[model samples]
Target: MSQRHVLQVFEQYQKARTSSCQTVAELANRPQNVETLQNAGVMSLLRPLLLDVVPTIQQTAALALGRLANFNDDLAEAVVKGDILPQLVYSLAEQNRFYKKAAAFVLRAVAKHSPHHAQAVVDCGALDTLVICLEDFDPGVKESAAWALGYIARHNAELSQAVVDAGAVPLLVLCIQEPEIALKRIAASTLSDISKHSSELAQTVVDAGSIAHLAQMILNPDEKLKRQVLSALSQIAKHSVDLAEMVVEAEIFPIVLTCLKDTDEYVKKNTATLIREIAKHTPELAQLIVNAGGIAAVIDCIGSCKGNIRLPGIMMLGYVAAHTENLAMAVIVSKGVPQLAICLADEPEHHIKAASAWALGQIGRHTPDHARAVALANVLPRLLSLYMDAESSEDLQVKAKKALKNILQKCTHLPALEPLLHDAPPNILKHVVGQFSKVLPHDSKARRLFVTSGGLKKIQEISAEPGSLLQEYINTINNCYPEEIVRYYSPGFSQTLLERVDQYQPVI
Candidate 1:
């Protein structure tokens, strides 16, 4: 049928317009037909109906516009260009519960498309209206309004601050305290969006006292709600030390540790992220995690999760070990070293391997025991390989190189150090040779292995300036061996000597 026929359907009597609007909404629900419906000017037909006299026709028209806008950014911008938001925002306050719900959904649909579209909604003065809708007695209206606010706030810092400036936080806190699970999830999620943009905005969220209430939802059996709640807490906690401590002060440490063992991966992932944010700040906070037995739980998380899901746990391990020697020891005692080693060696993604390598560096950098723990896990070779691999990303390569140097400098384990002599770059080789220099002069056993493993041969081939540290280290290692052994291992030692002997004229 022509566009005229579609319009005729809505142009009929009140009952016919209501039926037509509902029919278009249902048809627009299918992804395949949204284009066909839009090409027919379905939006233009539905725009005017948003202000229809009859309640059902008005709300249904709003619902249809929402579905059309929900399909794509183009359609959403069409809704914006078609001048639909102002009517919806205007309707949001004056309409009944159902109409308010439908209008708020339309605003949400439009705002979700882009920052431009969301800004359009904000520019139309939707935020204050949406904030007011949060107070509606009907849970559905409140839920729709909360979702719209989240979409608008999620784009950037300025828009997020605008949502905060419009006074949405306290009412959002109120929504989380409501009995509805859906309401709680969206409210928590919206709060996360608002708080994620800046420390000031996050402080606004914290000052509203959302953490204690969010923490109380931890034991709820709903995985979806738990994800949002954890996300909100993580966002708020990620902003500043005081904010993170506020989350800690709520005593979710033990609960979050237990959550690491939860069957749901999202809960586990978000749980790991929340811990990571807290563990990142200070030694005292890291100690708080250690005292709560967090390292073992995170180790288990790293072991059980595959791919990117393991990322946060890997990062948490790094951040904790980054703080202090005692904290690094806590990670070592929990057997985090081997787990990180396994990730660096086995993970298919370079980013994950980089994260693992970084964490292992943190664990190994503090002291000899920490370094030995990493070296003994057999992680040094894999780190060197990643640094040497041409396919590795620069980020991965840099992290791997850093990790190798860290572990190598403190490592006295001669067996591990011996192999690194053959391949480690000049920068890393210095540390490897430095270790051998420190240890070989004092021990005969390492000197023997140094020759038997061809480590002496590898050292002789390295081209360093006469007075360079690498040459100095090579000279030190050569001194540990007998003079005859050093002479035999020197590069082209026989060929140069034979030519010199043939050209000798000292007697003449």
Candidate 2:
């Protein structure tokens, strides 16, 4: 690792080139030694060894350069600038499986740092060699080649299209069906990376018959494989309704729901995310999950996980509830509001809390029973508090305000609203006062309390613009009371005194 130690590894007569190369590779494997080895100009030494007459020496030198590059971007660029990639790519077609694996690894390590480095590998014609390597008798070379292509494709749409042009998708699909779990996991992940960039890219993967092959792995006992498989499905399903329908047609549900209960948190998270993507497309698609009991399973997933893990499940509930009143009721009936309420109240993250508030509004905005369900869960007051908090981000404030406006317009429960009058800003107060105007006029007891509890006085205190809707609401409430009480509650005096005259009696 030290400069002195690196020189000793290359003392050509003291140790065979193979032994020296292997020593450096092993030492570089320890992350702490990577920088020291690089600073000693080990890249300069490893450059020639990449083409050594002994194949193992070439393999180990590539392995050492890869370990150094894998440590950070600087070394990755060093590999690119060291002129090692052309040799590595050149050797891929000719080397034995072990040498090919090490060379492919060097490319993957170099490429993973950034698109610039990946593009450098492609400029040297690594893709054609890698694509051919995909068919090699050795599965190790195939897996390594797959990883390099995946890393290249991940950086941008142009690069992903490039990988597609090289015809990696069908081969990747083949890798997905292979017997090795690691190969399946990486293959699935690469498909996800490839499909995520654009609809065209996703359609390419689908055309390769990836959906059924991927669907078969949904319940695979390997948690890591299941995560990638779910993630890949989520990516493909995200592009369009037709694509989502194709995923659904696989009959992978009910069983996909079982993944929601997986012990691996990522599997659970990705499962929820996959369901979220599908349900977002259509009411009928959402209904599939509901029929499969997705609502209860997702709520349990939300309840069991925390932080970002809960986000997709929370949104799954929102998407389902957002589709229709019946679906919303399904969420409510499944005890979703309290879980959402808990997220809104307790989660430290603003975005998750914002999601919870928005979902609650969707659930509550439908009808009085729905609004009452949200009300009973103590959700509105908390939503109001989030809206009023100055520290909340503008996005959070916007979502909270929209949720409030939507829910309060449908809310008929008055006790839940009384506290809002003191705290709501002018915009929200209009809804609260309007709810009061609707109820107090019909219930004598509420009308009496509106006066006795100083509710009328609170209405009088609001500085509503003369012709605004708030002023109109005040006039309507004044008609509910005797003219004297109306005049007494008026801010100063009122032309509305005559507006209230219908309630007056025995006037001269």
Candidate number with greatest TM-score: 1
TM-score of every model versus the real structure: 0.93, 0.90
The list of candidate 2 runs beyond 4 A from truth reads: 1-16, 448-454, 484-508
Candidate 1 backbone collisions, by pair: none
The Cα local distance difference test for each model comes to 0.91, 0.89
lDDT of 2 by residue, 250-319 (tens): 8988999999889999999999999999999899999999999999999999999899999999988988
After superposition of all CA atoms, the RMSD between model 2 and the true structure is: 5.8
Global lDDT of model 1: 0.91
| Candidate 2 worst ten-residue window by lDDT | 9-18
